[model samples]
Target: MIEILNPTLLARARETGALVADILDTLRSRCAAGTNLLDIDRWAKALIVEAGAVSCYVDYAPSFGRGPFGHYICTGVNDAVLHGRPYDYTLADGDLLTLDLAVSKDGVAADAAISFLVGDARDAESVALIETTERALAAGIAAARPGARVGDISHAIGTVLGEAGYAINTDFGGHGIGSTMHQDPHVPNAGRPGRGYTLRPGLLLALEPWVMADTAQLVTDADGWTLRSATGCRTAHSEHTIAITDDGAEILTLPRRAREL
Candidate 1:
């Protein structure tokens, strides 16, 4: 369903977006060498509950995933990319970790993700991969404006990834998000411009551009939720919830503070 937020709803969306961004910033800072994935999930849960918000993931049973995600956030480490279910994994130095989070506050939901390297070790390749996704995300957002089609955003995102030499996967991409977590208008990482859903004021979209280092194929882990690269190649993902405005797009999930390195 495509939900056009009224003034009141828009305010709630902003609040939810800020909350998601803050939580991600906190989690990214806390993650480091020897950090446990479960601990991060716990921290997210505490913060969400404390803020009187709800988790869009918990108890969510989609056809593609195992029932009841049962986790507060998604932790994609190294090869893992999307729908990464938190497990007993402990982060290692130089490990590329991606955290994707969505929360509902005041009945509005906002989603966002960030990819970062853990600990003191910053591998050049890993840094490049992370930066590429971030740049692609920015390009996608820049293309989102009133009267623009979803394809415009997709094309902008794909250009950045393709130029960076990363393999793109369309099996899963961005989508409309609002009162619900996943809604209509599937925004692919790559596509032709001037096609698909047309942008309108009040529309909210989550544009995510993710890529694997050397493969477009994905393999589901035994857990049935974590999506990993077919060749075990390192991957990166970046995302944010944006609102279509009369003049342009407003990024609702942007971080308010710089996360500690």
Candidate 2:
């Protein structure tokens, strides 16, 4: 279901977006060597409850995943990329971690994800992977606007990742988000420009650019949720929820502190 949020709901979306971003920022700050993935999930749950927000993931039951995610946040480590279910694993120094979150406030929802190193980042490859995903996400946002097509955004993101020498995966990508977490039109990480749904004002899109260092193939972990790189290569993912407006795309999921600045 595609939704074009009205102004009132859009306002709520911004609020939810801020909450998601702030929680992510706080989690990132708390992450360090010896931090357990399950602990991160607990922290996220606490923050979400304190904010009086509803988790979009905890009770989520999608066909692609096992029923009821039962986790507040996704914790992807190193080779793990998408749908990373939080588990009992201690983060080591230089471990690449990706945290993906979504929440609803006042009946409106927002989603976002970030990838960073656990401690002092010594792996050049990990740093580069994270940077490339960030750049790709920016490129995708830049291509979003009223009258622009979804493919344009996908193409822009693809150009950045392709140039960075990372393999793109289309099975899971960005999508329309509003009252619910995931909606249509599916926004792939790579696609041809001038194709797909045309953008319009009031449309909310979650643009995510993710890549694997070596291959595009993915293998699901035993948990029946976490998706990892088929070749055991490290991966990185970056995402943000944007609202299409007359001027351009307004990023809704930027941290409150960042928005203040």
Candidate 3:
């Protein structure tokens, strides 16, 4: 459903967005080599409870996924990209990790994702992939404004990824978010400009730009949740929840520390 939130609801949205961003920042700082993915999930759960928020992942059963995500966060490492269910794996130095999180506070939902490398093991290719996704995310956010079509955002994201020489995957992408986690208006990583749903004030969109190093194809892991690159290439993802306003797009999911700066 396309929801144009009311003023009070929008305020609640801000709160939810802040929580999501704060939790992601904390997790990023805490994750390192020797850290178990399951520990990260547990840490996320504690943070969510401490904030009095609800997890959009646990008990989430969708047709595409094995019912009931049963976790607090998605942990995508190296080849894993989307819907990566937390497991027993411990992060290694230089491992590329992507953490995707969504939560609801005061009845409003916010979603965001970040990709980064672990420890001091920084592979140039991994760094490039992460940087590319971040740049693509910025481009997509720049294209989001009142009256702009969703295609415009898609095109902006596509242009960045395309120029970086990464193949685009359309199987899963960004979506609308409000009282619920995933909503209407699927924003692909690539699309034709001047087409698709037109943006409007008060509209909230979670625009994510993700890419695999070599191919656009994906393969589901035996765990029934992790989505990995079909060619076993490294991947990266970046995302944020944005609200269309009169001036432009306000990125609600930007970290509070960043906002303070």
What's the TM-score of each model vs. the native? 0.97, 0.99, 0.99
For each of the candidates, the C-alpha root-mean-square deviation to the true structure, in angstroms, is 1.8, 0.7, 0.6
Cα lDDT listed for each candidate: 0.93, 0.94, 0.94
Which candidate would rank higher by TM-score, 1 or 3? 3
Clashes of each: 0, 0, 0
Shift of residue 255 alpha carbon in model 3, Å: 1.5
Q: Write the per-residue lDDT of candidate 1 for residues 1-261, one digit (tens) a residue.
A: 888888889888988998999999888888889999999999999999999999999988999997789999999999999999999999999999999999998889999999998988988888899999999999999999999999999999999999999878888999999989999999999999999999999999999999898999999999989999999989999999999999899999977773233
Weakest 10 consecutive residues of candidate 2 by summed lDDT: 118-127
Model 3 regions more than 4 Å off: none
What are the per-residue Cα lDDT tens digits for candidate 2 across 1-261? 899988898898889999999999999999999999999999999999999999999999999887889999999999999999999899999899999999998998899999999888678899899999999999999999989899999999999999998878899999999989999999999999999999999999999999999999999998889999999999999999999999999999999899988
**lDDT (10s digit) by residue, model 3, range 1-261:** 899988888888998998999999999999999999999999999999999999999999999998799999999999999999999999999999999999998889999999999999778899999999999999999999999999999999999999999989887999999999999999999999999999998899999999999999999998788899998999999999999888889899988999999
Q: What range of 10 consecutive residues in model 1 has the weakest lDDT sum?
A: 252-261
- Which run of 10 residues does model 3 get worst, by summed lDDT? 6-15
